[model samples]
Target: MRIVVAVSLFFLTSTVFAQTKKPASKAVAGPGQQVYEQYCLTCHQADGGGVPNLNPPLKQTDWVQGDKTRLINVVLKGLQEPIEINGETFDNVMPAHDFLSDKEISDVLTFIRSSFGNKAEPVSVEEVKKVRAAK
Candidate 1:
C-alpha cells in the first residue's frame, strides 16, 4: 500500500544520503607542525635544536618552558634582544612572524611548545588571534 511505498522511499533516500556522505579528513598534526615546517625549520631544524650560537635550540629552554604567555608574546612580536638558551646566549634578531595567519601562528606555537622534549599545551587559533588583535 501507500505506507509501504513511502517507507521504501524513505529507506532508499536515507541509504543514498548515507552513501553520499563524505568521509572526514584525518586529524592533522595540527597547526603547530605545519607552521614549524614552513617557517622554523630553516634555522631550528626538524629536531627543534638550532645550530651552535645561531638559532638556539628550543629543547628544555626556559623561554619555552617557564611561561606560556612569554612564549606566545615571542611568537607574536618577535624577539630582538639576546636570548639565553640552555645557558648559551643567542643574540640573533628573530624576525617578526606577526604576519602569519592566526591558524599558522597557533600551529607553530603548538609545535614549538610540544616538540623536542617540550610538553606544553597546544596553542589555540583563538589565542593567536587574540594576541594579534592586541597589537
Candidate 2:
C-alpha cells in the first residue's frame, strides 16, 4: 500500500511539474499551394517539371510567365492545339479548370508564375475574374 501510494504521488507530482515541448516551426502551405497539390500536381509534378513528351514543363516557360490574361484563359478553357516550347512539342491535352473560383484561379496562377524557377508578377483576382467573365 505504501509503495503504491508513493508511486501514485510520484506520477502526480511529475505530471504537475512536466514541461510542454514547443512545437517545431513549419512552413505552412498557402491556399494556392493547396489548390495546386490537389488539382495540378498530377500532370505538372511536384517540382513543376511536367512529364516529358506528355506535358510541357513549367520551369522558366514563357507560357507560365507571360501575359496574365492568356494564362488565365488557358486555365479557364483547356488547351486543345499542340504547342511547342523550347523546340519540344507537347500534344497532350490539358483539361479545363473552370470549376475553380476566381480567387483560386488567380492564386494558382500566381503560385505557378512564382514557382519552378520563374520570376513573374502575381495574377490578381480581378485579372482572373475579368478573363473568366470575358469567356
Tens-digit per-residue lDDT, 22-115, candidate 2:
2222234677888899999999899999999998888888789988888898889988788997679999899999999999998888888888
All predictions: root-mean-square deviation over Cα?
Answer: 6.9, 5.9
Worst 10 residues of 2 by lDDT: 19-28
The whole-model C-alpha lDDT of candidate 1 against the native structure comes to: 0.79
TM-score of each: 0.73, 0.79
Each prediction's total of clashing residue pairs, residues at least 3 apart in sequence or on different chains, is 2, 0
Task: Output the number of the lDDT-best candidate.
Answer: 2
TM-score of 1: 0.73
Q: What are the per-residue Cα lDDT tens digits for candidate 1 across 1-135? A: 999999999999998877666432223455567778888889888898898988989898888767766777887788888877788999997877777888787778777877789987887888777767777
Best by TM-score: 2
